[model samples]
Target chain A: MKLYDRVRVINDGYEGYGIKKGDEGHILNAEIRYGTFCFYREDPETLADDASASVRIEDLELVEDGGATDEDILEELPRHNPEWGCKVIDGFIYNLKGERLNEYAYDYHHRRIK
Target chain B: MKNLEALYGKVTDYLKYGDGWVRRENISPKDIDVCNGEATDDSDTRTCALCVALNRTVFKNDNKPDYTHPYCKCEQIPTAPPEPTLDFPMRKITDYLFVKKRGLMYSMGYSEEDAKEVYQMIATNAKEQFKQGKYFLNALDNHGQKVNILLAFPGKREKEGHVYWIKTGWTVYPNGKLHQNTPFGGWAK
Candidate 1:
């Protein structure tokens, strides 16, 4: 229902997208691109560890209260490396050092930029 | 070629189903040099990055690919998966991104008319940086390995001698193909 909410797949419609009933994931984005919610789903059994996908809102059931928020992510970002500072400018997220921090390129861990 | 044959068999076994198996759809002879599997130079092995990723995924349950003995030495089996060749799907750029992020592209030294050129530049640079292991690992979602890289281009302030560093996102698939996820993630330092 909200970003960072832990949810479980409750619909079989997402089978083709590699999701199935009872699969758990963390919501990443909500209802922007044509009402589809994007979430990061991981299945250790099949080695789908880094999997993410988007589906209709009706397919998910919220399982937890909170996961990560904007402030939470930003607070965690600097701990990955002391030199990094995060900020958002004009709808795009970046580090104080000027590194882009959006999309799959998001180095909240500061692993790639340094 | 015995080592290659053995490696191939191992991959096939791991991906095998009762009556079906993973398809080696995009693999080509040119992508891997089997005849020179015994080459002294690592180019032949390096070229097998895709195959290495494939097998690496096969061994994911154990967290590492275990290629053994004669095949290990004779085949130059790398202890780790080599940097895979990147797959930049052009339509993702020309059609979707160019239309969606026209402003961001322009800010990064790319114009509406420079879509193809810009895409080519990103693809080329991404491949080079990836080979150098400059990419950062992001979360794995969508059944793919999410990674990011910082790429530099002639900046919007080019006349002032500034280089624009952009963060690009990609999904590295199990088959060793990488598809660009975000053409732009904002300007990098």
Candidate 2:
């Protein structure tokens, strides 16, 4: 089986729907993590169009030493807003609006890890 | 929902026999010829039969789920199937299959029109394989008859590559056949 050399992080604007840069809506101190169980074909078009595409969460680790204390966390608040919406599923960070984020989330949250 | 089922059935028939079956539904022959283009004698009957069986077995629900209309036929469905507890990694296999086939198609420099046609062909074939129960090896299922298949491919993202994942639901047959009712959009990527 072929494994991706490096996981691609498709950070587009989907998750941060109503939330803004400094808004509390951005999940910053919540130890947010995300990943996906992707079903992709070699071709870009197919990969893009796969309706069944999904992601899964393996683990959610605390953003330990996120470069600061509470004061530091607050200082870095703007940066914490996941320049894009970063969700944690099965211990991986993934963008929400990408091709497989929802599927991955469903699989992981629903415990369909394989 | 019944209308949606009828539409789904019609689309499946169209995939199985090209546009001819649709033409038989009182559609004009000229429209059929235009939509289907030139008919190739290389059609595989095995794929058609498998599609018919898979749709019947997997999507035969009488009651519609509380999600979007099943017959919408939009690129993205408003709702997804309920997540199952089974650990069948069928999504991985389906992904691998998609990547393998699409990668080959892309490498061959197929035009958009050709790619779309080929994509539909692959989906139909996969549905047939699933129906025949002869394609995949490892799978998991719940009591509801929902099955998942795990698949892998070997290759790099830029070059040849293989990866693993799972796929769920009855729309896809257990044998790894493509659904005859739907056109494959993967090739358009």
Candidate 3:
């Protein structure tokens, strides 16, 4: 997904985040962390991107606005982090095992809890 | 006086200094949230004062290396609009938390795919660990060697009701240079 590309949520989105199934949100930015997409609630009042989410490319059907194609979208998607690409779910970092790591405690990234 | 004592309950929270020693903090849960993400602002679940001030002075501010509660895995903002909890049905660990960077994975002797597999193993089986100055992990490494792991859980949040969410984890080894790059190996050991 590219910035400002109109997209629709295929599956029910995260309710806690106020995302619902079939909710049409604008792709505020892609290349979020890993291969995830960041979008915003389609509202003028909303300034920042409403949500940063990882959607299966299949789960999001592209909204045609004279924007990029399937290949373009896929190419823009990063396989992994070019930088220290940690997943920040609701602003906390976790390892792949669903356990929590205290990386963001301080120092932009906190020193590891010894 | 007795009521005040009950209100400001003496809770000795663990504090870390630069020298790598833990200092005992005698604090009382303040009437307000006091920065630690207690679920209710009410008295029952509140954390104490010294802990709150230390949280801001050390963890929230620029004070070189940071200090943290020994048990708080996730650093949820201790303020209004508590961070959202895991929406999905709570499980042992979140399967979605992946390795941070591709090059880091390569450096750690793992292909992107292999690193993902390793992460999957860590999150699926970590229990609530509360050991100070130690890795609270018990898992097998890729080669089946038993290892200690650290996972970040959702810190104090209202959605989580002042409890922790076992959201993510990472694996570590003692002699990390002997094996993969364990992020917490140097300090955690």
Most lDDT-accurate candidate: 1
Higher-ranked by TM-score: 1 or 2: 1
Find the 10 residues in a row with the least total lDDT in model 1 chain A.
Answer: A77-86
lDDT of each residue in A39-99, candidate 2, tens digit only: 2222243332232222222311222222222332222222333233233435333432332
Best by TM-score: 1
Report, to 2 decimal places, the DockQ of model 1. Answer: 0.02
Q: Residue by residue across B48-105, what tens digits does model 2's lDDT show?
A: 2112222212221222111223322112112222221211222222322233344443
What DockQ would candidate 3 receive versus the native complex? 0.03
Please give, as one word, the docking class of candidate 3: incorrect
Model 1 segments more than 4 A misplaced? A1-53, A57-114, B1-83, B156-160, B174-176
In candidate 1 the C-alpha lDDT for residue A25 amounts to 65
Best of the two (1, 3) by TM-score: 1
Q: Is candidate 1 or candidate 3 better by DockQ?
A: 3
Candidates in descending TM-score order: 1, 3, 2
Pick out the ten consecutive residues of candidate 2 chain B with the lowest summed lDDT: B19-28
Compute the lDDT of residue B141 as modeled in candidate 3: 18
Task: Return whichever of 1 and 2 wins on DockQ.
Answer: 2
- iRMSD, model 1, in Å: 18.4
DockQ of 2: 0.11
